[model samples]
Target: MKSDRPSHEDFPHFQTLNTRWMDNDLYGHINNVTYYAYFDTVVNRYLIDAGGLDIHSGPVIAYVVSSGCDYFRSAAYPQVLEIGLRVTKLGNSSVTYSLGVFAQGEEALLACGQFVHVFVDRARETPVPIPATLRAALEPLCAPG
Candidate 1:
């Protein structure tokens, strides 16, 4: 938690998310688990909207192979969050999404995490090259060195 978190500008894509009442815990703040949900939301929303993924009946699908989060500050219900996203790694069949939760117009991170997804053949459940269309869509979000 001491290292510097990436700024909002570091992300190439973003999704505006509104925290809900159910997202809160008994302590009255959004639970740690909900941050993962936020991570999934922005990643998949970009995949479907920008990556042209067919979640319902496509021959290919993306599965979350790994995920993690680091909470820097607590987020609460009734808060509108800017879930910023970038790709730090893009492989033949997998991609790593770097994400951050931030208050609107804020550069400081509330939370940050990485979500990894492996593209696979739907029926065979075997790894497959990421689709051209999807790869193209993700290119812009891949941050440079």
Candidate 2:
């Protein structure tokens, strides 16, 4: 992997994620798949709390439409991670979130990934315009020109 690390300014929002002992694989480092979990947690937590998403009864919901990750360094247990976030794209009924995970206080990122969500009507399972509350909350995270 290249030694280049993205600057903190590259990301908009940030969250601290704890690495659990169980997150490590037999290989002795955090499994590649766990990074995706971290990505999901950071993005969903913001949506659920700030966007007012009722994971249970909300008439509208967002589902992961796609996701991917690129690892630059290994992350092991007992380490605290700072997950940076931002919206790469916001469409009529979908948003693509980009995330960068760094070892706490580190300027370089250990991994970077993206989560694309499609907002839909829970009952009809059809795409719907993004809710105003959700949009307002996500506005700040939207990528700048």
> Candidates' TM-scores?
0.95, 0.94
Query: Which candidate number would show the highest lDDT if scored against the true structure?
Result: 1
After the best TM-score superposition of candidate 2, give how far the Cα of residue 123 lies from its true spot, in angstroms: 0.8
For candidate 1, what is the lDDT?
0.91
Q: Rate the local accuracy (lDDT) of all candidates.
A: 0.91, 0.90
Candidate 1: residue 95 Cα off by (Å): 0.1
10 residues in a row with least lDDT, candidate 1 = 1-10
The sequence of per-residue lDDT tens digits that candidate 2 reaches over residues 35-134 is: 9899889988999888898889999998998999988889999999999999989999999998989999988778889889999999999999999999
lDDT, candidate 1, 46-104, per-residue tens:
88998789999999999998999888888898999999999999999999999989987
